[model samples]
Target chain A: GAGVSQSPSNKVTEKGKDVELRCDPISGHTALYWYRQSLGQGLEFLIYFQGNSAPDKSGLPSDRFSAERTGGSVSTLTIQRTQQEDSAVYLCASSLTSGGAHETQYFGPGTRLLVL
Target chain B: AQSVSQHNHHVILSEAASLELGCNYSYGGTVNLFWYVQYPGQHLQLLLKYFSGDPLVKGIKGFEAEFIKSKFSFNLRKPSVQWSDTAEYFCAVRAYNNNDMRFGAGTRLTVKP
Candidate 1:
């Protein structure tokens, strides 16, 4: 079975440009998450999606950051007018259920975004 | 706001040596604790988790963690470590009813052969 996967393993862009990172969750998974990891730092939660309900965007750093999960299977995180501080590794994860009690999230290899 | 802390930033040990990594959380409510590991050039993988029941939980790769509710701690331990165990370890915590999860700064372990 395919695990959580993210495309564009590496991306280099200007500080003022916008970039979109994509993620494909495992089949049958109803929970998806996006996180950002700075160099030598831990994961920082960005957004979460559970089934057809509204996505949780509380973890998003700013309005410039937005994410969408279409059809409840694939997700895309877009950063508008990216700043140098936005450069980091973007990781995606998915779990079988949305319950926080026993959900074991599986992570992806991550996309390393570099803002020059 | 909830947060997680990992005391050790980096650790180095020889093969067959015992290993222990400390993890603590600030949330007072019911929270799920987890330990994840990431090997070189590999994705993060779950090492263990403590949702309920037994406080002492065993995980893959001869690893285990003890969740001490009294101290708000979930420390990971391995009696004997192998060189392959060298990797980065992260401690995470999430509230039982919330979707947001917090992670520690991570501890990098290096095992000498």
Candidate 2:
């Protein structure tokens, strides 16, 4: 079976620029998530989409960071006016169901974004 | 807001040596714990998880984690590690009621042959 996939494995952009990172979840998956992995900062949850709706988006750091999942299959995270602090590897993951005591998530190759 | 902590930043050991990585979460509610591993240039993969029942849960590659509710800890351990076990390990947690998940700063393990 095909696993989760992400595009543009690496991206380099200037400060104040906007960038969009894409994620394709596995077929039949209903839940999608985006995370940011920064140096010495661990994995920070960005957003989660159950189907095409995002019920919990409190993890988004700021208004400049937004994500949307279309048709409950693909998700895109857009960071507007990116800052040097936004430099990190963006990771995406998906699971079978939305709510579970323990839902195993499959991850995709992260997109390394460097804000210079 | 919930948070997770990985006390160790990096570790190095010889093959056949025992390994232990400490993890702690700052949530008191019912939670699910997991151990994820990322090999060199590879995506993250699930190692093990603990939801309920037995406090001691075993994972792939001879790895195991014990959940101590009293201490709010889930520490991963392995006996007689192999050089292939060298990688970055991350501990994650998800509450029982919400879909939000949190992960700790990963610990990089290097097992020499």
Candidate 3:
């Protein structure tokens, strides 16, 4: 409850279907981030939300991917038309503030997404 | 653009053995360094970080890392490891004033009893 919480610890869906992953960050945290960890690959930055500033979606692999943080607390990452390559561990993290010289990010038990 | 590299993909060690995992990054500007651990079936937890002050920083569970700015290296070390230490480790960094913290591939460490 105190830490970042992600829904559907595990989800398996058929290819070409859409999937939405949710993340609830710690209270008072203003900065939220989404990352993907593919098998044997590193954690890839997917998106970042800072306060009210425009989210940096530079890491989204394609236009098919998008995310939104409503009310600065709950965030969701949606993958449209999932493919085999879309299977990975979806991780969510949040920091106390969006900006600062150095801030630690608390992570959640990633949601394991599988596309069949 | 910034990226992180973990030298060893897999490392095997015996109980009480010394351990070191190398991490390097390519970034021209200032950055913050961090090491996170993920035990089997657990979420990623912060092991340590290097923001400023001492380059050689100590972290939880008797872990430590030294940030070598000139070489752009931040390596994790443990004097003695135990079987319970087996886990996946990740290194990350964020720009001097940025919100994005890029992560390294990750090193799987298995300490045998």
Candidate 4:
């Protein structure tokens, strides 16, 4: 089975430009999550989606950041007016389900975004 | 809000040496603990997790972690390390009922042969 996959392994964008990162979750996975990993920092939670329920947007850092999961399989994280601070690796993960103690998240290779 | 702390930023050890990485989380409610590892040029993968029962949990690659509720800690350990064990480890915590998971700053382990 193919693992979670992300598009554009690396992206370099100018500050104030918008960038979109895509993620394809594993087959049959009902829970998907997005995170940001900065140098010398921990993974920062960004957003999450579980089945047909509303997406959890509590982790989004600002209004410029948003995500959408269409048809319950693919997700795209959009960052508007990207900042230098937004330069980091964007990782996507998926699990069999959400809110279960036994669920373990499987991560993708991640898309490295560099804002100049 | 919940937060995780990883005591060591970087640790270097020789092959066959014992390994221990400290992790602690601050959360008022019941939580799930996990250790994730990232090898060079690879994606992050689960090492182990603790949800309920059996405070001690073993994971792949001879790794294990003990959950101490009293101290709010879940420290990862291995009896012996190999040169291939060199990688970055992250400690994560999530409330039993919450969807948000928090991660530590990560500890880099360097094992020499």
TM-score ranking, best first: 4, 1, 2, 3
TM-score of each candidate? 0.98, 0.97, 0.96, 0.99
Instruction: List interface RMSDs for the candidates, in order.
Output: 1.2, 1.3, 1.6, 0.8
* Shift in Å, residue A25, candidate 2: 0.5
TM-score of chain B of each: 0.99, 0.98, 0.98, 0.99
Which model, 1 or 3, shows the larger DockQ? 1
Give the alpha carbon lDDT tens digit for every residue of A23-45 in model 3.
Answer: 99999998999999999988999
User: What tens digits encode model 4's per-residue C-alpha lDDT throughout B20-41?
Assistant: 9999999989999999999999
Candidate 4, residue B62: lDDT: 99
What are the per-residue Cα lDDT tens digits for candidate 3 across B13-43?
Answer: 9999999999999998988888999999888
Report per-candidate DockQ.
0.82, 0.77, 0.72, 0.89
True-structure lDDT of candidate 3: 0.92
- Candidate numbers, best lDDT first, in rank order: 4, 1, 3, 2
Q: Given candidate 4, what's the lDDT at residue A87? A: 98
What is candidate 2's lDDT per residue for B13-90, written digit by digit as tens? 999999999999999899989999999988999999998999999999889999999999999999999999999999
Give the runs in model 2 whose Cα sits over 4 Å from its true position: none
**Clash pairs of candidate 2?**
none
**Best by the DockQ measure:** 4
TM-score of 4: 0.99
> What tens digits encode model 1's per-residue C-alpha lDDT throughout A1-116?
88999999999999899999999999999999999999988899999999999999999999999999999999999999999999999999999997655688999999999999
- Per-residue lDDT of model 4, residues A1-113, tens digit only: 89999998999999999999999999999999999999999999999999999999999999999999999999999999999999999999999978766698999999999
